[model samples]
Target: MAKKVALLQGNEACAHGALYAGCSFFGGYPITPSTEVAEVLSGELPKIGGKFIQMEDEIGAMASVIGASLTGAKALTATSGPGVSLKQELIGYACIAETPCVIINVMRGGPSTGMPTGPGQSDVMQAMWGTHGDHAAIALVPASCQEIFSETVRAFNLAEKYRMPVQVLYDEIVGHMREPVEFPEPGELEVIDRTAPSVGPEAYKPYDTSFGDVPPLAAFGSGYKYHVTGLNKAEDGFPTTKADLVDAEERRQISKVKNPTALADIESNEEYLTEDAEVIIWAYGSTARSSRYAVNELRKEGIKAGLFRPITLWPFPEKRTAELAKQAKAIVVPEMNLGQMILEVERVAMGACKIAGVHRVDGEPINPGQIIAQVKEVL
Candidate 1:
């Protein structure tokens, strides 16, 4: 039998999820709608023999996570809109150094603290392209409390597997709302550890591309002393001024995630009302929750409407959207942002179907009725 517990808020579940994901280090600064995540983790991490630090600001927090990750620890941090902005540069540094770290951004209204406590899905594109330069990124959006936990673990796995930074993008509603969650047994899931080189210290190169661009990582005090920096460098960890070496390093950094088949781990619930009908509705995150209810209601009214949701926000899952678009006559994209995700949807749709973007940025979710109306209009 499944255990039934009281509803758990998304932030609490996120902290618990990080704990379950074997996170031993947390460095963060508190901000609205996301503070609970840092608070819960702070209390629980120490009890489980983990370390938690409340840094002076978000930049220090991000730097601390990268440092902890290089030491071979599964590390994480949680913050909100403005804090996320502060960490972008260090985020790029982590990308260059190939640090395995998880960043949870419980998003509120953005463009610099636009609304501290209000809900918003405005961080979609920023979470994907916020860091400077070209680098591989994976952003997972959780629509409910259950995903808060699952996605946090997924963030860790991806970070470690790719040896890169992964973001679990959360909206204020999902971060603060309460819902039931059942955690699975620990051993049932596969955990990917960082690849450590077995070569002798004298023969090892920390950034050797031959090892699938992932060299065995040596810790700071592991006796195989090496240098790590944000600058372009060679496999031996020395800074290089060569253009070819710079291009090679940048490409290698991106290819690790781009080349991996796990890039498009999309989760969507679609109805085939459109298999015979004319219109499709696309939405995600909190808005998708409401859009789902609306789609069902539309079906009840004999309207042929279906839904498309993206679990993996980054990488955009363009292929799936393209496939769905090819089969439909019209498409509706509802998002909390002012067309941020919708732009991607349109790009992926490839103009195969008639498409329009429905968006809201008034610190509220794009409700169900609005989506149904949009679907009807498109039809």
Candidate 2:
């Protein structure tokens, strides 16, 4: 059979990728710029024997996804910034309870109901720390419609593998932009499912510590009957106030995702013209698209500029950034927000290289000209 190629919006690609990644349940409320994700899934999931529910609000949508994931379904939900705020408690619940799920945040201008149709990257920090408490987060930012599709699949795979919620963050520009996306033929793309309990029901412990950092998850009705709660819990999954047990559980949750090996597995970035360039531009999402163009143009003019685009937002890809910092004389970060990710770059670069920020927040995207000017200024 010929490969399927379609001109799809970012939201449509996300839904398609979720389905291809074995997502069987979707629960989301309709929000501008992200509603298409729910709409697409609502129509497509039923045809494939999966389920889709339009919830009353973002909080309900988030809770529904957690419930679905508990039943061993690969569940997903889509929302924008305000919706993400409403979903925070449940997101934290999923973290503490160790439920595996995916959340897509098609970012719009923010704080309150800022701008529904405009783009913003202000949620970069929120994606890392919006949910209360200490827990590791995994967020993937896609630059193009095609990447949003592929990264959605990667998000589900990481969520299941790490037993946590993984977020896909794209801005309004990418979300509404339409482009041709070629999906892999069946069996061409690798799909990962959660590991089932190896022991008999009588011996199963949902949060078993004996196995390793990530214990296998048992389905809710699979006869395991393990307890799950937001309160700090023990290895058996029951809530506890015991300081020692609480401390241990928290550490395990952090370690599970932060383990060097696991972190390396999930980190992704793109490097263009960095090999011999003196100035490197750091960007993500739609901003990277402009930065890439600027870098190419600068290179042609005999200015040694490069581009570093991070796909994995959380876990920040600091190691790779630091490595590049060692080689480059200056680093320029252009983001749609008023400098959310630049702080991260500055921290990682640590005086190793001169760093500059190009920020835009008038509900407009940072263009290649703006990025090129910043690159020149820094040089």
In the range 257-366, model 1's lDDT, one tens digit per residue, is: 66636554323243435566567787777887887888889999988788776777776776778888898888888877888877887888888999987888898878
Candidate with best lDDT = 2
**How far out, in Å, is residue 367 in model 2?**
0.6
Model 2 residue runs over 4 Å out of place are none
How many residue pairs clash (N, CA or C atoms closer than 3 angstroms) in each of the candidate models, in the order given? 1, 0
Question: How much is 358 displaced in model 1, in angstroms?
Answer: 1.5
Q: Estimate each model's TM-score.
A: 0.95, 0.98
| Model 1 residue 29 lDDT score | 95
- TM-score of model 1 (CA atoms): 0.95
All models: lDDT? 0.83, 0.92
Q: Roughly what TM-score does model 2 have, to 2 decimal places?
A: 0.98
- Cα lDDT tens digits for candidate 2, 264-352: 89999998888998999999999999999998899888999988899999988889899989999999999888888899988988999
